[model samples]
Target: MYMPWPLPDENWFADTSRQPEPDHEDLRLEALVAQRLSIDWTTRRQQITVAVQNRVVILAGVVSNANARQVAADLAYDVPGVFDICNTLRLSGPRRSHR
Candidate 1:
């Protein structure tokens, strides 16, 4: 039966069907996440792992010192549209002693 306002047709059971697609918000979020992951910090390359979700970026990895950690956080902040950041970076390497 055709399902139309003040109109009905026997072809209501037509084989043609509309497929649902991802919402614009979902697409936007996905694009932003991709951009976040693709970013590479020049100061610390091997000591970082970044994950982005819903505009929130999560960083989990190892660093050499407090300076390195600062670098990581700053990198996350540099990415546009990043509203939240969860830093879970562990410090590594020996601390430089000041004489």
Candidate 2:
């Protein structure tokens, strides 16, 4: 009698194995966002994190003020291939008092 080889586990061919790599457009978008944030004078570099997914960018972290938050959002929006922006940056700095 001849014996057949054992079959591999079903999970071995799961979605992870066929995962797609990041395309050029996605990389460019991430770079663009980084550059914009780096060069902008209004942004607080230490308190921001940038994430790019499916052409949509998510901005998360703490900022000095609302303007900084808006600046981040606008910078991300200007990048090509950016489908949408989700600005989740929180403001934690002391408010400026107007005399």
Candidate 3:
């Protein structure tokens, strides 16, 4: 059996606009979320992890308190691509005084 050579679109070679691919949107959104999270100095950004899928943001990790968790959620919301948020942050319990 013989296979014919594949035909290429005429404009494909001429177009050099360097448009972003579809999959790149996720990375772009993730970067945006990370940037927003970093902007807040109070929250422990290092302890949290952000997951973005289909425009929904899922925040997971341990925070010092409920307010910190909420702050993480709010940071996620500030990103333009985030459509919904699922906050899974856990509180680390009350801080005990060290002797």
Candidate 4:
């Protein structure tokens, strides 16, 4: 068998395990959520604050009823990559539970 006289050696210890992390995805998601909640549904628009940290969403605002609370939670849950959501959204009206 014949081989090259001056062939270079192949790489055997190259580092290929480190991956770059995303920087602003969480901040963008939080801002989008807040904007969606602040939109006016009926005659006048209400203000709702949304804060997201490490895929956990926290909602704080004056909701109309339990339905509103549920909707808020659902909205946050629908977002992709959500781990645990903290629903602190308070309702403005009275409380009524089906169960």
lDDT tens string, model 1, 46-99? 457666555676778786677767766776676666687788878887778999
**Please, what is the whole-model Cα lDDT of each candidate in the order they appear?**
0.63, 0.84, 0.78, 0.66
Per-residue lDDT over 1-99 for candidate 4, one digit per residue giving the tens place of the 0 to 100 score: 997565376544656686455337678778766655555352024335777777788877767667767777776677776666788867676569999
Off by over 4 Å in 4: 1-23, 38-44, 94-99
Q: State candidate 1's TM-score.
A: 0.51
Q: Pick the winner on TM-score between candidates 3 and 4.
A: 3
Clashing pairs in 4: none
List candidate 1 stretches off by more than 4 Å.
1-42, 94-99
lDDT string for model 2 (8-40, tens) is: 755644577666777777778888898889889
What TM-score does each of the candidates earn?
A: 0.51, 0.69, 0.65, 0.57
Question: Best to worst by lDDT, what's the order?
Answer: 2, 3, 4, 1
Candidate 4, lDDT over the whole model: 0.66
The residue pairs found clashing in candidate 1 are none
Worst 10-residue lDDT window, candidate 2: 5-14
True-structure lDDT of candidate 1: 0.63
After superposition, the stretches of candidate 2 with alpha carbons farther than 4 Å from their true spots are 1-20, 44-46, 94-99
Writing each residue's lDDT as its tens digit, candidate 3 over 1-99 gives: 998665674454566787545456777887788777777875745478877777888788888878888888988897786789989988887778999
